[model samples]
Target: ISQGIIFVSLLIFLLVGSLNGRQRTFVSDTVENKTVVEKSVTDYLASKFNTMVIPSLYCIVLLIGLPANALALLILITKTKITPSTIFLINLTLADLFFILLLPLKISYHFLGSNWLFGEALCRIYIASFYGSITCSVFLLMSISIDKYFAIVYPMFSRSFRNRSKATFGAIVIWILALFSIFPFLLSQQTLYISDVNITSCHDILPREEQNSYYFHYFLFLVILGFIVPFLVIIFCYISIIWTLSMNARSQFRAKMLSTLVTITFLLCFMPSNVVLVIHYSEFHASNHSDLYVSYMVCLVLSAFNTCIDPFVYYYISDEFRDKVR
Candidate 1:
């Protein structure tokens, strides 16, 4: 049954990835005086489709993730052995819970047709927590992969790395790094200003050129540092672990299963958004009205829901908590 669920989840991820890849976007023409451009109705439909999913996912996060993560936290904190591995799970649950707690602010914003009913202060804090939790989650997952690598592949060296003190320190470092990383969003983003349209949006409200420049630089950094570097580390660690396990008398099945789950989780939860980001930033400077707007919405929804799926990842891979769930 667990294997079936894992397979279905992978299939869902692949479907989402394929759909994202098929999305058509509009890049601006360099020609002079091209104010109006053609936009496919299909792109518009895709945007609406993406936006629709956000609320459904919001329901899951609120109705399902919140309680599940909260319960998991109780279990991990009160019952489970406080190994470095479990410490990371605890941090993961905390991040998920923190992010889930902030979902109403976003759901309300989106349900109101992208209007920011919450004032500027919350806009900043909520957005910070949003980005901060996500960054923390990714790096923590990377840390988990690192922990498992040592534990499964190098048992002798694993002990030195698995202490409670070091994991706590690592958690603090991840939080601090995430906090600083999102600091720029608070200062730079502002409510959209348009005299004609009395609605405020909570993102880059700058001129097209300026916003694109800022997004391009930062998105590039995230792709490299946030996704790519962590990805390479995870792949290397898991590959080595798998190689070592195959040579050992142990089943090696669980190690392979965990690595597969991790890799698929990253691909589904992180890779699509990262790819969309690269495409979005590259063409953001050159986007026309129709296609550009739709693509933006799709990217936004995908990025926001990235954290929403972490619960499933936790449930599937963590042996310590799996039995507790049953």
Candidate 2:
């Protein structure tokens, strides 16, 4: 988990640093005759249309995922013997459910051609909802890995110390951390003004000069807290688990299987965002020619895809889920 956090933190720093880098103008001779503001609007409309495609697909999955996850949560709660891992999964699913609920607002924002009809307060809530979902997902995954680490490597100690109450407390702590981490979106400047066309946008609309600073700081923080830290912990736990299982040939196969699943889960959920973030940063800082905003839109789509893929990963990788299905 800590390794994941570190990875995310580095990407965020790269993005934020790029944002604070020297400003590059997007306008060229061809763009000059047209209203820059209107062009921005038009670009946004096109981007919005593109953004709608993935989220719409995701909404369908969420439709299935939310209820399934809810049922799973209920089952876990009713179990006579509940594990710490179940506690983490419950919170993870809860966050995902909330995430699913917010998808409509996001989808609608794009469907309406990038015009944020939801106003400032809702805009803030929208951003927070998205950020909170993402942060909670990362932290909860980390917590699960930690629980697995203890269960496998220190079974008796875990039985004594990692009981239901501690598990619930851990989940609470992760949620609180996520809530605090994403609160900044609530305080951020969400509206962008176009002086040339008398219009406003709900996207992070810092001025050109300030945009870089915002990105630099935001990216740096995310890299540290979001990716780097979580990834490290996840990797460390898995390593210990693998080592412990390997000492006994009977469990070696299971350890390998679990390691493979964990790797696939992390790669599917986090790797795309990491790559997209890097590309987006490059595009942001590129001087004369690149379409940075387009790059950002692409990254945004990838991030959303990450959100959608999570439920499937959860279903497939969870042994508890499989047991229940049987």
Candidate 3:
């Protein structure tokens, strides 16, 4: 009976050992499978483009945009009276400042081969601000377009309601709306470590499975309300302005020129990225893979130039702005 008890104990020990060994082996296998399944940034089509083209552009934007936007903000505030026009210009400059201030991290991310050393929280903040600023610009530009439409098309009638107080309120609502639009990104993880490259990418990679549930809808809505709607409104406002102006105003040329510039800025800076991102997230949601992300990244780089271009828009949109410069 004593010998029987010893045998049973030995059998139980062996079974436990075997189970632990199997568990370890399973865990290792799952990790190995994950490594093999996930493609690193090095293998990505945009990887080379990111390391090469993006950093340089970001550097240029940083060098040029930081001071330009700061100066524009100062001028918009101290140089002009706080009219609706000036309020919009101030907010636009603020948006550009918020975006370009984050560019240093972006530049470092690219320069270091897309490795994100800043950790997860910074990554989330970076992406949130990145997109928040973009949406802000789109919305503010639309507000400005509407302001221009009221000022130019119905100047006499608009004077009753378009005051400093209303403009300030509008600006606040737009700011809240723009950042609120990015609330989803703020809630999710934005940084991932790629085993193949031994690098952590900040918002450079999206989880293949996460898009279908929420992101697909978020990006689509963002593009529509944040960009497409604003774009159409801007176009309508500009068309109305051009149509309403009398030829003798010589200011007719200024209106036409400003309209052209605003259209070009929207087309070049905001439209492509918005379009590409919609396609990217949609395709990624459906197929678990996307090919247009490289285009989206490139277009985002173009969007960053909106930082440099916004000051010019201020000059054209506000006569007070032009007067301040002169």
On residues 204-296, what C-alpha lDDT tens digit does candidate 2 reach at each position? Answer: 344444445556566557656886678778878877887888778868766666656665566555654554444444456445322444544
How well is each residue in 212-258 modelled by candidate 1, as lDDT tens digits?
45556766787777887887788778778778887654546766776
lDDT of 3: 0.75
Better of 2 and 3 by TM-score: 3
Candidate 1, residue 16: lDDT: 47
Error of 1 at 1 (Å): 19
Better of 1 and 3 by lDDT: 3
Q: Which candidate tops lDDT? A: 3
- List candidate 3 stretches off by more than 4 Å: 1-40, 45-48, 247-249, 285-291
In terms of lDDT, model 1 sits at 0.66
Candidate 1 Cα deviation (angstroms), residue 122 = 2.1
Give Cα-based local distance difference scores for all models: 0.66, 0.64, 0.75
TM-score, candidate 3, is: 0.85
Q: Write down the worst ten-residue block by lDDT for model 2.
A: 21-30
Instruction: Report how far off residue 142 is in candidate 3 (Å).
Output: 0.7
